[model samples]
Target: MLIGEVARHSGVSPRMLRHYDALGLVRPTGRTVGGYREYSAEDVRRIFHVESLRSLGLSLKQIGRALENPSFTPSALVGDLIRWTEDRLARERELLGRLRAIDASAPAGWQDVLRIVELMQGLNSASPARRLQTVLARPEGVSVPVGLLADAVLAESDPNVAGALRWALARSGGDGVAALAAGVHAEDVDIRRRAVLALAGMSEVPGVAAALADALGDPDPTVRGRAALALGRRGVTAAVPALVGMVVEGSSDVDAAEVLGTLSQDPGCAVRITTALVDELAAPAADSATRIRLTQALVELPVTSVLEVLRQLAHDDDPAVALVASAWVGVLDERSAEDRGDEDS
Candidate 1:
């Protein structure tokens, strides 16, 4: 077959066939009287082989080696090709994600498109300061796409940047609640923690309570703690056990105690919260420190509700716990006296 006939039958262009010949990748072995290049059957088969390797993302140089070198192994090269294709696919997916975010923003013009692109680039920047500045410097009233903020907040590692992103999400009127909710179940502990932290601030948003409720079972105590605290603030009774556990475990015990205190404002919830704490205190596993922490938490409850527990604790065997409980009993007595005196007046 001549070059044109080879091109016609094999779909390889004449110019590319000539280029392949010049590179010694697939040189035609025959020539006519007019001295035009002619390809033998084997040469045409080599051309197909080169095209096949190119389809697998092999460079021309690599293809030449693959075809010519007897020692060349396809296994390692195929593995490398798989990785390179994966990397290319990942880049394409990321670029597609950026485009979707930009499109989701519904930019009105080229300028808006530029601004959104710039914001995304800044959020992804290597410098934490740049990421922080990007979030902070967003022009007022230019609503960033909620999805963009959601993605940023989930992946952000720097404390300050994460806080800013959460604040921005909050100000977006809870638009990113679903994304943050999904992050609550993320495999990464840090992402789960960040998601709950962001959700904690958006309790007023619909579905946030449910998301936090789901987070109450998170294996990470920090995620569960934040979720419990958020739910406790919302007066969700389901948070009682976690909040009480927080107090007993000394994980954000102060904040947990404060929320428990707030939840105790309800007469029924007050009984439940107080009973849970007392149960933990009475558990055999309760150590001195645990007892002491539980005792301090009791101080946050209503004096009337916890007075009996404190009085009993005041006479407890542990001297440190007894001292703390004794002091709280006296403080409650004084407060009760002050109230009684005012009522009498």
Candidate 2:
């Protein structure tokens, strides 16, 4: 057929036919005596195949490869195509499941649900960490919807889940950290304590510091002590104020004393903070046993400032406080001299 006739029958424009001919994508089988282009039945079939492949998103190069070899199985090509489609559909189904869960929830307590939906959207767009971080930021005691919790639990099992969660947590805001911090108030003290410890290890959200600070006041001595230790582990200067308050308040409770001792050993803690703690322990109002425990903590740090703090404590009215402080000061002095010698060498 002539070019115009071929265009009409094939549903391709005349201009496109010419362009395909120029690119050698499609060519005439023969020419008339007057030089008019002629397309054979086989050429028409090839044109249909080309159009079909193009509609399926195959590039011209891919179509050429397929057509060049008639021995290539259509079933093989179609199987490959179906596999790609199925993979994409699976991901879409996961996203839809998350969305459906969110839509079914009431607004009054749907923050976690909404967050889950947002995370699913992120994953649909190939982001998973942003979702995990959102989960980590809820306030202590606030329970995320069961669905949202399940999503996080499932994410933990995914190989890529950790990387995404870490990235998102690193960039999380105060509100997000607060949510996770609130987990400290959960009725399940063990769960709450574990959550608090996890949050403390996270360097991403600054809000964890505030949460830890508040946890020190928990009615449960164990919770309060854990919070103090978490702050100390984090080593943020901001926590120094809270730690000092805990030391001076002198929890009569053994757990509280243990927590105070842990905070005293924090590497990030400054000399001045330790000194104030020592002074508090030496006060006439202070308990001699607590002073002894505080002295042990000062010994653990072994810094010059800590030694100085201990020296001040050596004058305590309690003979045991003075004796323990003096012993620790001698050990600290020896350690400091050795450290200086190493530096000099």
Candidate 3:
């Protein structure tokens, strides 16, 4: 076969085949009387082999080594090729993500596109301070892509950066809620914690409440506690059990008590919250310290039923608890007496 015929059959262009010959990747085995390059069967086979290697992303130099150097083992070269391919793939993926983020922003012009790209790059900076500064310095009234913020929020380990990201997401509202919600289900507990924290800041958004409801059952106590705190404040009765658990565990017990008090302001949930507190107090697992926290939580509830429970607890076995319950009940009793006397007068 001649050069043209070889090019036609092998799908390697004539120019590329000539370059291959020049590089000694493949050379014609003979020439005709006119001195045109001619390829024997072995030469054509070599051309196909070169094309095959090129298809696998081998450079011309690498192909030369592969074909001519007996010392060139496929193992090392293939390993190098694999690493190179992987790096290229990672770069492509990153570029694709940036393009998608830009598209999702629906940029109005080249300036908007550049701005979003810059913000994304800064958010992904290696330095935590840079990421936080990027979030804090976000342009006002210019739309920051919420998905980018959501991703930064989940991946951010620095507390300051995480808070700024959450603040940014809160202002951006519903745009990032979907991504934030997905982060809530991530296998990494830290990610789940970050997701819930971000959502907790944005719980006023339409779907965020529902997402938080799902996070109430998170396996991580920190994750569950944050979710429960957010949900309880929203007056979701489903959070009652977890909030009660927080009181017993003394993790943010004060805040949990305050939220429970707010929830109990509803006549409907008052009895339920009261019953939960009493049950924790009665549980054998409720150690002295646990019972003390639970007792303190009772002061936040204004319901009349808590008075009776406090009275019973006033004379309990733990003198410290008894003193706390008795003093608290006495204070409530005195306040009630004052009100009754004023009404009678």
What are the per-model C-alpha RMSD values against the true structure? 3.5, 18.3, 4.1
Cα lDDT over the full model 1:
0.93
Off by over 4 Å in 3: 1-90
Each model's backbone clash number: 0, 15, 0
lDDT per residue for candidate 1 within 1-345, as digits (tens), equals 899999999999999999999999999998999999999999999999999989989999999998889999899999999999999999998899899899989989999999999899999999999999999988887879999999999999999999999999998887799999999999999999999999998849998999999999998899999999989988898999999999889999999999999999999999988889899999999999999999999899999899999999999999999999999899999999999999999
Candidate 2 vs 3: which has more TM-score: 3
The lDDT ranking, best first, is: 1, 3, 2
Candidate 1's C-alpha runs over 4 A off are: 1-56, 67-79
User: 19 in model 3: Cα distance from truth in Å?
Assistant: 9.8
lDDT of 3 by residue, 304-339 (tens): 869999999999999989999999998999998998
Q: How accurate locally, in lDDT, is each candidate?
A: 0.93, 0.63, 0.88
Q: Model 1: how far is 296 from its true place, Å?
A: 1.5
Provide the lowest-lDDT 10-residue window in model 1.
135-144
TM-score of each: 0.82, 0.41, 0.76
Model 2 residue 201 distance off true place after TM-score fit, in angstroms: 4.7
Q: What does the lDDT read for residue 223 in candidate 2?
A: 64
